[model samples]
Target chain A: MTTVPRRDRPGFYYPKPPATWWLRRPNYVLFMLRELSSVFIAIFLVLLLVQIHQLSQGPAAYAAFVERLRSPGWIAFHVVALAFALYHSITWFNLTAVVQVVRLGERQVPPRLVAAANFLLWGVVSLVILFFFLLGG
Target chain B: MSTRKTSEPFWWGLFSVGGVVAAFLVPVHLFLHGLAVPLGWIPVSPARIQALVGHPLIKLYLFVLIALPLYHWAHRFRFILEDVGLHALRAPIAVLSYGSAVVGTVLTLWVLLR
Candidate 1:
């Protein structure tokens, strides 16, 4: 059975979106930014691992690295990375509401409730981290 | 575009788990070490931070935090590049992306163990 390929036939124009298609809509841009956030977060992890490696080297090396971080450029980078990481977390939690649907008896749990729960958990976890810093132990 | 492969689910499974881990843990880590201590918002010293990292539980936490997110980033970045029209290099992109994550995971474990 010999069949002609669809693309080989006439009038089969499949439009390809431009590279900047994300700029076409606000939501699309947001989605792209959310995806891009992972890169910054990964970079942060690598730097943290490097810091850990420095810690293993000696106190002097670790202190030097920490001292270097006091520069304005590093601070600005951290600020931007913080924004991206927070955005990534929020978007990921909201996505959980869509991905996991729970049913109680005959009624399904509302997505808003799910999202709220996620935010609440996030808040609690953040507070616990803050508590550690506050307790200084 | 090339068709999806059977192995996609396996890689995607890692990506999903990584996303969940990153979403829950990453922000808090950034807020504490990345922002607070560095900015002088928290009065913790480097020795204190080092001792915390020396703890077994924190080491394990760091391992999971650093390793999984690499894969998550790899998967997302691969798709983004492809969607933006790097379809011809899909196979190579997948290899490069996932390879970096694997290398990252190894580096994380080695550092934590040391």
Candidate 2:
């Protein structure tokens, strides 16, 4: 009888990607930062939700909470979070061009135009918000 | 590898929708609340904002704004951690990440209802 080969026998060695793989390329660094932007945005949302909770507590509590955020350190943290949130938003908008396919007749819509349209919509919405909060107030 | 089907597509679907929502709305919110308000570029009181939040429409808006990005964050962070070489802990990590998002969503709904 022929001897059967064991299934658990040694195979070719497969090298694992290094922990510093992101450091190898600029695009990798950008990708990591983009991924990290979500975390920063999440932190901001948590802070906002906490503020709303304070609001429910009463005006004094809400005013006190907002006052606490005026500290230089907290302001700086918000600044950084804002930057990350903006970065995340921009990258995501750009990606919509890739994920969505729009064809006009037999011709495909250009990705650049798609991205521009996204940016335009973003601008319009932001402006509406600004009008409501900044000027209207 | 086991032939078990994954719920990854479902989670990814949420992430995709959340990404669109976050991209469209989050930056403006951040700019208004974080930078403009604190620096006094816009003169609005806490009471005004509280009243705004009290509206039913605003509550629904906040639910969408706060809840979806959470799952988006969860999914992205899960992959990032995995990429950094925590391959062995995939299942536990997925549970923890998505579970946190679900908890956040519930908290948002509770706060809105209150």
Candidate 3:
């Protein structure tokens, strides 16, 4: 599935790929998994919306929501969601070099340096948010 | 297909912006809210968090955080469907994919702004 099968012309060849084509190759499988990460992240967003709604219902409702989230099932779901969120973040940040090019004078920076810079920024941002969450309040 | 005439670039631009936003922010948000607060790593107080959420800057931040990554998901998920042999159903799938993101974005706005 590297290249899409174009629309079949009158006499041209366009092989009909099976539904399981992505499963045949490890890279394709990995790609599909990465795409799938969005689904989990989107669901996580919906859960967040629900959480905010709970908060809007005042302290008691928010506390009840937190209590429900503390259950084993919700905690397990969160674990999986966090795993996918990390996967999405790592892959997205790793592609920064390919997607964005930085220049020093007339020369382009090395891809490794670009990727490293992204990772470093990610760490700083994560630390700041963590600080806010853990202590700012 | 004339790419210039259509709105693909607009969505792609959003996808790129959303990619940057999600890559930088989502992981930390997930870690703190999903695991830390729930599992007792960080203290979970409803009033404290509510107070934080009530701030205008935090409300705007929340709106951006929840809305942008949605477009990223929509664009990627659309291509994923196309690549996996659903290229024939491109029209409806594109609608459903982006339409859901649009809905999610509206929902986010309603929740955050309210």
For every prediction, compared with the true complex, DockQ reads 0.65, 0.68, 0.74
What is the C-alpha lDDT profile of model 2 across B1-114, one tens digit per residue? 446697988999989888878888888888777767767777887767877888898899899999999999999999998888776577899999999999999998888888
On residues A27-56, what C-alpha lDDT tens digit does candidate 3 reach at each position? Answer: 989889888888778777788889998999
The digit string of per-residue lDDT tens for model 3 on B1-114 reads 333478888999989888888888988888777778877788767888988888999988998888999998999899888777787799999999999999999999899888
Error of 1 at B68 (Å): 1.0
Q: Model 1: which docking level applies? A: medium
lDDT of 3 at B68: 92
**Candidate 1 structure, TM-score to reference:** 0.89
What is residue B77's positional error in candidate 2, in angstroms?
0.6
- Cα lDDT, all candidates: 0.84, 0.84, 0.84
In model 2, which runs have C-alpha deviations exceeding 4 angstroms? A1-15, B1-3
**Which model is ahead, 1 or 3, in terms of DockQ?**
3
Tell me the spans in candidate 3 whose CA falls farther than 4 Å from its real position: A1-14, B1-4
lDDT of 2 at A63: 74
Error at B83, model 2, angstroms: 0.7
lDDT of 2: 0.84
The sequence of per-residue lDDT tens digits that candidate 1 reaches over residues A1-137 is 22222343465443567778889999999999999999989988898889889988888998788777778987887888889999988999899898899788999999889999999998897788679767854
TM-score of chain B of 3: 0.95
- What class would a CAPRI assessor give candidate 2's docking? medium
